[model samples]
Target: MSKGQPNEVTGRIFDGATLRKILAQVQPYRGRFVATGVLVVLLSGLVWVRPALIRIAVDDAMPTGDADLLLNVFLAVCGMLLFEALLQYRVTYLANWVAQSVSLDLRSKLFQHVAQFQLRYFDKTPVGTLVTRHVSDIDGIANVFSNGILNAIGDLLALLVVIGTMFWVDWKLTLLVLTPIPVLLLATRIFQRVIKKAFVDVRNQVSRMNEFVQEHVTGMHIVQAFGREKQEAKAFAAINASHRDANIRSVWAFSVFFPLVEMLSATSVGVLLWWGMQDVLVERMTLGILLQFILYVFMLYRPIRQLADRFNVLQMGIVNSDRVFKLLAREERIEDTEMARAPEQPIQLRGTIEFENVWFAYTDEEWVLEDVSFRVEPGESVAFVGPTGAGKSTIINLLNRFYVHQKGRILIDGKP
Candidate 1:
């Protein structure tokens, strides 16, 4: 439950500080980020053009038997589709490029940060936990850029454009088409909350499985030597089952949510048809406008559905960002401050070592070495003779500065 620990699952979906940190990674890729934004905007605007061209072909060109006008509109629609496709490619490529770049930088930074951590930190933390942060969690952040944030923005813009066009064609039908939206929004809100928890559990379970597998694999020799293979296998099975169940929960949430979105979408289209058909029969609304509205209805609902999925991606990314940033926040490394400054000129090593009344402990509960004192003069061969856990290795570790002594001075060549 400590900070940076992957197993800690909280209900909150977004952390502002974590988001700011994630965005800070994009400062180096601002050009690509801006370019992707512009492309997304262009794509959103271009979406309306195709339907407008179709409306012109159906209502105006067909009625006058103007084959030339119909051909021109068809060409225009085709050109727009091609142009949209091109923009989409650029957006997708640039977004992924930036994402990969950012992830690379983050992974390197996380690795360097972890490298500077003290041996005690490694002793207390699992290697698999760090592996998850470096590998899977960073990939989650990459997805935020490539699939979550930019795509969600594009979807929102497309949704707005579709709704605006629907209203322009016929405000009454637009209002009717939107009747199911409130219900859909409610379902989405519920789904978001449920899936956020599920995703958090999924992430936690992934970290657990990683830790379990890594520990067992590294200790496989000990497992076989101690005849604990069956017990370890049973433990692994339990961890695997937990991982499976967590994934299934997230999948179940998706199954329910997407179908509800599709059902609401279908119902909206049905109601639009049933109600607008009367206007069509009376010649109050043109067949082209009704057709345009139908297209707009699909356009509007598709993005809404996608937005929910995108939000889940963003949610998972945020969860990862929180954990990764917390790991970066930890400062457990030994600090060689100004007070411990080395001499401007290199000192000649005389092979003299001294430990004066030193006290050391890996933890506060018990002392590994207490009130110890020793001196090995230059050209003297001193042997440290003791059983295991008798401060033998601790003495060497203290002299090498791997762990700082709690009380007293360790001097090299009489320099403390």
Candidate 2:
């Protein structure tokens, strides 16, 4: 895709190659990444351990009326909580450090690539678009790691561990508790679709808003001088409204989806309670097991709901990643040859220039400087004046190598 090409939000959210390219940026911090991953795994286990300990306390200590056993479980829970908190802190710090570092490296690389692009590239590409790539888009990518990717992994791990424990206690009750999973998953799918489109619009609107603001501010003098302040202001307001509407759409999707998730969660818990109570009456299930399942349900739905939210972050990051990668992949219109180099020592130009039978045009077959030839010896001063739209400025531009003249040789001190 070209630099200014719009990103399509449908179909696949992330291209495999594009994603790989994005992850490759983290290769420099592999050690930190491994450490973060280990911490996440440990934290996930610790999260599940709390409910397991509670189950043991209720089942073993309470049944036996052993206060010492109860106190030991309580102390162990406290100790585990403290340990989990410490590991969680380390994990968050490492993830954020990697994220900020990646953002820094990515922005620097983007700026360097953009700098190498010829002047014409900038002429066609808006400054606001570039700013979005460097600033907002890169932030989105950082979010993928800090909040979306690794954190989502931890969420999934927690969900799996909770499910596993639920089944270990009672598969029948676990299945009963999970009856709402399909509904929640379907809602998540719908939310993903709605949010994808909303986010795409949000990004586009942001770019447009930036472009409009930048253009107006740079040309504010012209706008006010022509008594077009009201017109420009109206235009700006319209764009601003578009930006706001796009963002609101995303928020609205969230507002709706989260409540649905909560409702489903409540329904699942209600069903679990109704079924578990029947089993308790029959002596087929213990109160400790029932309580453990209730805790597990909270553990389960919390991550499920959070998974949906984190998926949003992941999707936004992918969208921005697509744009940033496209910019990086853009083909430069002008590039110096391998042999191109500056002189070893500082030397003053003799000011001798020649344009031999040069043919030039900004567009096809519409010549601005057709079959043009000129020469000026050292110390000579000459002016070629012409009306507007004539090739006067083109001559100066070609002489300075800001543009390359077609169809002939342009020489300085008789060397091309």
TM per candidate: 0.96, 0.93
Best by lDDT: 1
**Least accurate 10 contiguous residues by lDDT in model 2:** 1-10
Model 1 pairs whose backbones collide: none
Can you write out model 1's per-residue Cα lDDT over 177-214, one digit (the tens) per residue? 89998999899999999999999999999999888878
Q: Give per-candidate clash totals.
A: 0, 0
